[model samples]
Target chain A: MKELEDRIRRDGTIKPGNVLKVDAFLNHQCDVALFDAMGAHWAQLFAGRQIDKILTIEASGIGIACVAARHFGNVPVVFAKKTQSINLDGDQYVSSIYSFTKQREYPVIVAKRFLQAGEHVLLIDDFLAKGNALHGLIDICKHAGVIVEGIGIAIEKGFQEGGSKLRKEGYDVKSLAIVEKMDADTGNIEFATTD
Target chain B: MKELEDRIRRDGTIKPGNVLKVDAFLNHQCDVALFDAMGAHWAQLFAGRQIDKILTIEASGIGIACVAARHFGNVPVVFAKKTQSINLDGDQYVSSIYSFTKQREYPVIVAKRFLQAGEHVLLIDDFLAKGNALHGLIDICKHAGVIVEGIGIAIEKGFQEGGSKLRKEGYDVKSLAIVEKMDADTGNIEFATTD
Candidate 1:
């Protein structure tokens, strides 16, 4: 967690629309070493929780989820698809997610065969702003009758209500870095904790 | 490689359009353990190649690329984006790829900053059929002035011309499993080699 927070402080940039750009290492160009470390940290934090599967959204979350799955005893990772493909057919657990960045609502779906009933799942993602995506994942898990053991996030926007809202709901949400404040004009960023 | 081929023989379903569905382990529901093994095998195959990066496309390729990066000495994995997002801005290396399965042509873009000139990149993907996506990636790498040390594929449709074409063009293409033939009616799949 310290390493992640440190990386965020070093490489992350603040921009307009309350965006923290980390494409240099987090999203587009991924550091698998960092992801491995983060995965080990998450595995330790959620030890003995019986996480049967790791769930994430497409494109961005796939790398982190896969790397994290290594630390979770090589559990299978099932990513929710934001777009429908010909390969995806039959029964599905679908949920609508509102994107704060894209300013649009899209559907996220997972094959019902992947998330079985009574399985314990861990939700992982890159960022949590308004908890819309996380909430959508939770809804999908609920619909599939799977128990969400916890949520792991690389970075959370502390200025936003997502993290707090999930915490209030008593979800075991662990975020490596929380951006408490950001000054776009000055390019100054602050983390929630010094550690 | 044997493990991968065995898993494919067990779980892979042959369908119309030359589709060998390994979604249970390779794509939708990913087994990171198997990916780790495949990564290790790829690392050995491409040993001493001095690969600085692992290049892949979004969604399916991200997991394999991330897992494989660990074996490639924890190199950075950069996945090209199929769809543009608000976060993606500035100069980009773009290519047009035709998907035989989807029966459409779409654009794949990689941020210019990620793929540096003279960097050694290894392209990794889930499948190779018509070489459209692989060619697009090679084109992107060519535009960026990077050396593609080799290409790693989980499965290659040997019946198709993609893998053979790349080999003929002098690329170090290594596929874990190559399906020489598939009978959709009988659901029989055959790999090209015992090696």
Candidate 2:
């Protein structure tokens, strides 16, 4: 967590509309070594817990989820596809979520067979903004009658209220880095106190 | 590769229209343990190569790429974005690729900063049908003036021209499992002889 917070401080660029561009090591260009470390930290945080499956959205979340799965005893990582292809068969649990970055509402679905009833699911993602994607994954878990173990996030936009709202809702949400405030003009970022 | 071939034979499903659905382990519901094995195999195959970065497309390709990065000494994994995001800035290398699965053509963009000139890149992906995605990635590397060390694929539809064509073109394309033939009605799959 210290490494991640430090890396974000060094590489993260504060842009207009509260955009923290940490693509150098977070999203587009991934630092798998850092991800492995983060995964180990998450495993430590969620130690002694039951995690049957790790669920995340497509694209950005898949890399982190895969590395995290390795830490979780190599559990299967099930990513909810953003689009339904003809190749995807069987019943599906779909939820419509608005993407703050893409600025569109799209359906995220997981095959019914993957998220079985009574399974403990751990939701993971790269960044948590308005919480639409996280809630969508949670909705799918609820529909499948799976138990929500907790949520693990690489970075959380603390000013956005998504992480706080989830905590208020009584979900155990763990964030590696929380951006408390950003100064776009000065290119400065302040993270929440870990202690 | 024997472990991968055996897993494919056991868990892979053959659908109509020559579709071999290995989504249970390869894509949607990913088996990270199997991926770890595949990553180790790829590391062994591409051993003693100059690989500075591991490149792949979004969604399905990210997991394998991340795991493969671990085997490649935890190299950075840069995934080309399927969409040009507002957060992505500066110069970009874009390529329009046709997807046989979705039956559409779309642009894939990689930020210019990630793929540097003189850097050696290794392209990794889930499936290779027409090689559109792989070519697009290769094009991005060429545009960035990087050296493509090799290509690693988890599964190749050998019956299709993608794998053979790339091999003919003098690219080091290593496929863990190549489906030479598939009987959709009988659910039988024949793999090409590795030796």
Candidate 3:
């Protein structure tokens, strides 16, 4: 967690609209070595849980989920597709994610076959801000009668209510790095940890 | 490679239109342990090559690329975005991929900064059918002036011309499992030897 926070401080860029650009290492350009370390950390945190599958939303979450799946005993990873594709059959368990940045709700779907009843799924993602995307994944899992083991997040915006809200609900949510605040003028990223 | 071929034959569904759906293990429902083995195989094949990055297209390719990155020293993994998003910027190296399955040509973009000129890149993907997606990736690398060291594919339709064409052009393309012919009616899959 400390390493991730430090890496964010060193390389993360703060843009207007409260966006933190971590494309260099986290999402766009991935550091697989760091991800392996991240997977190890998550594996430790959620040890002893029955994680049958790794669930993540599309685009950014796919990369991290795939890497983390390696540590989770090579479980099957089912990523919810963010957009409609010919590959995605219309008969899907669909949920809407309200993207504040994009200013709309997009439908995320999963094939009925990929997710089965009574399966234990561990949700993974890059960032948890408004909790819309994570909530959407949870919805799909619920629709399939699956149990959510826990959530593994690369970064969480602590100032936002999503992380705390999920924690209050007694979900096993683990975030590698939590960003407390960021200054656009001074370009300083204040991390959440006391250290 | 033998194990992969066997798994495909057992789980892959041969549908109409020559579509071999191995979503159970290869793409949609990923077997991470198998991907680990495949990644190790790719690492061995491209050993000694100075690979600075692992480049792949999104959706299906992200799963394999993430696992393979671990074997390659956890090098950076960058995937080309298939759709326009707020996270995507204007300055991008873009290419058009004609998806015969989808019957459309969509723009695939990579952040201009993630890919740099003269970097050794290893292109990876889940399936190599027509080689159109691979060519799109290659085009992106060409636009950025990056050196493509080699390519690693999880499965190749040997009956198709994709693999042979790349090999003839002097590219070191290694497909973990190459299917000779897939019979939809009988559900038979023949694999090519590693040699």
Model 2 / residue A40 / CA error / Å:
0.8
Runs in model 2 deviating more than 4 A are none
Which ranges of candidate 1 are over 4 A from the true structure? none
lDDT score at residue A105, model 3, on the 0-100 scale: 83
Candidate 2 has an interface RMSD (Å) of: 0.9
For residues B44-131, what per-residue lDDT tens digits would candidate 2 score against the true structure?
9999999999999997899999988989889999999887678878999999998767667889999999988999999999999879
All candidates: interface RMSD: 1.2, 0.9, 1.7
TM-score for every candidate vs. truth? 0.97, 0.98, 0.94
- Identify the candidate with maximal DockQ: 2
Q: Please give the C-alpha DockQ score of model 1.
A: 0.78
Between candidates 1 and 3, the one scoring higher on DockQ is: 1
lDDT at A2, model 3: 81
True contacts kept of 1: 0.82
